[model samples]
Target: MTKDLYARHRSVLPDWLALYYEDPLEITHGEGRHVWDSAGNKYLDFFGGILTTMTAHALPEVTKAVSEQAGRIIHSSTLYLNRPMVELAERIAHVSGIPDARVFFTTSGTEANDTALLLATAHRRSNTILAMRNSYHGRSFSSVGITGNRGWSPTSLSPLQTLYVHGGVRTRGPYAHLDDRDFIDACVADLLDLLGHTRPPAALIAEPVQGVGGFTSPPDGLYAAFREVLHERGILWIADEVQTGWGRTGDHFWGWQAHGRSGPPDIVTFAKGIGNGMSVGGVIARAEIMNCLDANSISTFGGTQVTMAAGLANLNHLLEHDLQGNARRVGGLLIERLRAVAAQVPHVREVRGRGLMIGVELTRPGTDEAAPEVASAVLEEARAGGLLVGKGGGHSTSVLRIAPPMSLTVAEAEEGAAILERALRSI
Candidate 1:
């Protein structure tokens, strides 16, 4: 049945849409951190649907909210004063840390980033943008313009002139060998040099942890240094926290907090994890920047009652249960466990990331070259051993992405890590 479904999927879907594993899976149902395939096989889900399922599968709170909202009224758009929408907006604004923050909701992260771009471009009256090398924003035309990752970006044509900057990747760039202070200084100098050559830009968009680019991040104070330079020139700093937000990084409530040395970012774009599995993405910005556009705008499917309810429930659950602390504890153990095993594996070049959002990059045994084939083998092997992990990289390298729900138990983490260890060994 899965084979037949795969055949139909290929016939109808675009060729570029990728599926994982040698044989694709049809997931029938999931609960907690585990899922079942069409063949009734069980698997411990480590990827959490590409980091979207922030809480857990079949979370009762979120499920009850969705069901109750659906039973009441779910179709009310932004035209009406939706209670759930406003409440969720208030909650997000309080947590967003942007001064006088205002929230705008969308259906996906791409649209959220698109809105951020529009705001920055309009507020600054310039189309030139600065983005970190190997950064991934989203798939929309405007978002792809700012994305520096070649693998995720499909087109060069863009509405904005996006200049790729340095310091997103910490281990493989020209300044990789430098210590933390020197690395930050080098990247700041590079950014200054870039600014001197180009016209005034609207914004510098970056991911605190490069999600699709192998979970690479700069030194702690790198963005803070960049912030000072950008602030002097009136350029907005957009923190794309799509994959790193909602306590996934463990130590901080938001990934931008790690770089909060200067101040909170001018604008923050978020998606994926906020609603757990529900489609909820939004942008938060100060009043001046958010109100730049005079024309009335609304997202048709954005901020619907159902999605907002789901978001509210998910956020409440996350905060009430202190899942961030859980991620910090469990993720710490998991990463250390992974590092211990990775030390023995010749193919592992690096094990990096914060909290639950972690990456294990595989290279050739004795060479620095990326071993994508080996990564693929590991993925299949992991699936065979009843574990599900994801893969990502900016430049065709294979980085095993391990981001389970924030509520992952210590026992589950141990089990998943053991399964992953076996997979890496097999490869």
Candidate 2:
């Protein structure tokens, strides 16, 4: 049955939409941190549908909220005032850390980013954008143009002239060997030099942690350093928190807070996990920038009553239950155990990341060469052990990404780590 479905999927879906493992999975249902397949085999869910499921699966609060809202109405268009949408916006705006903030909802992270780009360009009156190297924003045409990773981007042609900046990844770069302070200095120097040769940029978009680039990140305060430079020139700083927002990183409620020495970013965009798989995303900025458009703008299906209802329940549950505290506690233990396992394996190049968003990079046994095949084999073995993980990286997809729901428990973390240890051992 799985084989038949895989064949049909290949025929019907776009080839670029990738799937994991030698034999793909068909998850029938989920509860807590585990899911089941058609064969009744249960497995640990570490990826959380690409970290979209912020809370546990089949969570009563979110499910109940979704069902109740569905019974009433789904879409009423943006023409009418939406109570749930207004409430959620109020909650997000208060917590966004932006002064006089405004909120605009979207259906996905891509659209949210598209909205950000639109606002930045219109406000600054420039088609030039500054983007970080090895970043993955989204799949929209405008988002793709700003992305610096060739592996994820499909075409070279773009609507905006993007200047790629350094310091997104702390390892594998020319300045990797430098200390944190020196690295920041070197990157800032490079940025100033780049600015000398380019047109004025509308904004600089970056992920607090490079999600698709193997969960790598620069040292703390790197962005703060950049913010100082950009602020001097009146350039805006936009933090793409699609994967790193809402306490997924553990130490902070928002990823931008890590670099808060200089204050918050100019604009913030988020999507994944906000609705716990309900397709809710949004952009937050000061009223001046958000309202800089000459004409009115609205999203028809962006903040439907149903999605907003789910979002409200999910956000309240996440905060009230203290999931971010759980992530900090459990994710710390998981990363330590995985590091111990990786130490015994020579091919496991590096174990990096904080909280639940960890990455284990694989390489040839004695060389620095990336071993994508070894990464693939480890993924299959891990699945065979009843554990599900994810893969991503800038060097040919050689990093294993481990991001469970923020509500992961200590016992579940230990269990998942044990299964992952066995999988890494086999490789």
Candidate 3:
């Protein structure tokens, strides 16, 4: 049955849409932290649908919210007063840390980012944008233009002039060997030099933790240092919190908080996990920037009742359960366990991340060269052992990304670690 479905998927779907595994398993249903494939095999889900399932699989609160909202009214355009939308927006604004903030809802992160770009360019009156070297924002035309990763970016033609900046990845760049303070100084100096060459950009946009760039991040306060320079030039700072928001990073409610010394970013964009799988993406900014557009705007499907209800319920559940604390406690133990296991593995290069967002980089045993083949073998072995994980990196996709739901238990973490250890040994 799985084979037949796979054949049909290949026939109908775009070839560029990649599928995992040599024989793609059809996941039919899920509960708690586990999912079952069509063949009746159950696997502990670590990737959490790319970290979209922020709480858990089939969470009752989210399920009930969606069901009740659908029964009442699923969608009414932004043309009307959406009570649930307004409520969610109010909550987001309160927690966003942006004063006098306003929220704009969209159906996906790509749209949210697109909206942010529109505001920044319109406010600054410049089409130039500064983005990090190893960043992956989204797949839209505007977002791809600012993306610096060649593997993910498919086109060069863009309305905006994008300048790639340094310091997103601290391990493999020109300034990799520098200590934390020196690295920050070097990156800021590079930014100053780059600013000298180009016209004033509207904003410098970056992911606090580069997600598709294999969970890489710069030293703490690196962005704060950059913020000083951009502030002097009146350039806005945009934090792409798609994967790092909603307390996923443990210590910070938002990834930008890691560099909070400089102050909050001028604009913040988020999606993934806020709705626990419902498509809820949005941007929060001071009223000045958010209301900068001259013409009226409305998202037809954005802020619909159904998605807003789900988002509100999910957010309530996350806060009520103190999932952030859970992530910190459980994720810390998981990383330590994985590090111990990796110590015995020849090709595991680094285990890095905060909270539940962890990455295990695979490299040649003694060299810095990426070992994508080894990563693939490990993934296959992991799947065979009933543990599901993800693969990503700028260097030939050689990093294993493990981001379970915030509700992950210590026992589940240990179980996943054991299976992963066996998979690494097999590789």
* lDDT to native, each model: 0.93, 0.92, 0.94
Residue 387 accuracy (lDDT) in model 2:
92
lDDT of 1 by residue, 69-104 (tens): 999999777888899999999999999888899999
TM values, all candidates: 0.99, 0.99, 0.99
**RMSD after CA superposition, every candidate:** 0.7, 0.8, 0.7
Worst 10 residues of 3 by lDDT: 18-27
| Best-matching candidate per lDDT | 3
Tell me how far candidate 1 lies from the true structure as C-alpha RMSD in angstroms. Answer: 0.7
Off-target runs (Cα >4 Å) in candidate 3 are: none
Per-residue lDDT over 1-427 for candidate 2, one digit per residue giving the tens place of the 0 to 100 score: 9999999999999998998877889999999999899889999999999989888888899999999999999899788999999999999998899999999999999998999999999899998999999999999889999987888899878888899999998888899899989999999999999999998899999999989888988889989999999999889999999999989899998888998899988899999899998999999999999999999767899999999999999999999999999889999999999999999999998999888899999999987799999999999998999999998998789999999989898899999999999999997
Residue 414 accuracy (lDDT) in model 2: 93
TM-score of 3: 0.99
Candidate 2: Cα lDDT at 330: 92
Q: Rank the candidates by lDDT, best first.
A: 3, 1, 2
**Winner of 2 and 3 under lDDT:** 3
Q: Show the lowest summed lDDT stretch of 10 residues, model 1.
A: 389-398
- Note the residue pairs that clash in candidate 3: none
**What lDDT, from 0 to 1, does candidate 1 have?**
0.93
Q: Which stretches of candidate 2 lie over 4 Å from their true place?
A: none
